[model samples]
Target: MKSNRRQFIKISTLGTGGLALGLSSMNLNGINAAYAANKNEAVSDEDLTPYPTYCEVCFWKCAAWTYVDKKGEIRKIIGNKEDPHCNGRLCPRGTGGIGMYHDEDRLKNPLIRETKEDGTQYYRDASWEEALDLIADKMGKIKKEHGPECVALFSHGTGGKLMGHLLKAYGSSNISAPSFAQCRGPREVAFTATFGEDVQSPERTDIRDTKCLVLIGSHIGENMHNGQIQEMSDAIDNGATI
Candidate 1:
């Protein structure tokens, strides 16, 4: 290696202007090996913190692992291998959840629209107190003019539970969700009409031990319920007919 460096210097001295070529040609394994050896030794377990969490982007709530670096920044997200629902596997949306924490454009505070005399309106950031006051004033006027039931809600699953409770407290029964009309709404309405009760989310049906399975309007395989998928696979393996 010493002789090789001396020869390279002699070549560079010959006006070849191949300094970059000399460096590129030189073996870097020794430096790389030393760096690799010290890499783990440089970081103690105390520097890295792994937090067990879950995805809230959807109703699934697949278990996840959030790794934090020594600087206290979230480094990565990994699916929890022990989670039976997803088995350490996450969907595309779940994998992109780190954006929820680190996105620069995310709303950090309230915003209100400021209108120009020319009929143009632009939004500007506002304080939480001012925003809540405006909301309360508007909602109070609506409740006085109409009824609380006139206030409707179209929300994602469970995310609007607090708002739902608030609406109910205000004597409003017009709360609704997209999940109702698209997925569970029709089933809930039918089930409630027949059974006199609301069906629970992710309906508890044991497909594994059952002898036969009858899917009416449901495409169970495409439903994306990991537990149900596992149970269905088990039922099929145990010779249960669909």
Candidate 2:
């Protein structure tokens, strides 16, 4: 499965440059500058500190330098220039990490339910002990009644490591990720069959140094992938073919 996925991505890359160009143009700077500036100023590091980390916005897992305030709050996230993949550039989604972490509607605690009935859902704040106990109990019941094979686990990108461990420990073989079905599955499959090797990211394309970029369906100006998008802009500014 892994080999097939890699092949598909390789072929797609040859043609995707065009598609990226088109996508990048639509919404690249639609964000209001004043609003963005105000939001930045409002972030307080007293709540969290920007820890040097990485982002999982896409499959690349770009290295990031995060600003965590004195209070342990994450104030901002920017790509690490030292990282070979992103090189100090970040997509809008990654730049918006502060909003995600501070979102009021986000789940902050474990939830347990006695039944699946609507409105019967009662949430109680739980300690780690309580949460683990509940999970273990449920897993035991599930294994005894439905068998371990009945369970399926789905996750994506980098943070899936922990979930992968949990699934393996639970003895379920039904694990899947949407990367193949959603973004790069077709490209990967094609590349693997033809070449017998996967094209890991930070793919060989050195767009920053390229003389000409032929974009097929990719909207390069709009859908932002930090390094690629920035290179496209520089190419245009320097009058390189798009």
User: Model 1 over residues 28-59: C-alpha lDDT tens digits?
Assistant: 44334424433543454567798999887667
Cα RMSD of all models vs. native, in order, equals 17.5, 9.4
Top TM-score model: 2
lDDT of 1 at 201: 45
lDDT accuracy of residue 239 in candidate 2: 55
How far does residue 69 in candidate 2 sit from its true spot (Å)?
4.6
Scored by lDDT, the top model is: 1
Model 2: residues with Cα > 4 Å off, grouped in runs: 1-50, 68-75, 113-122, 189-197, 215-222
Find the number of clashing residue pairs for candidate 2.
60
lDDT of 2 by residue, 4-55 (tens): 3244345445545654454345433423332343455465445555578888
**RMSD, candidate 2, Å:** 9.4
Give the residue spans of candidate 1 off by over 4 A: 1-47, 185-242
Q: List the residue pairs that clash in candidate 1.
A: 180-185
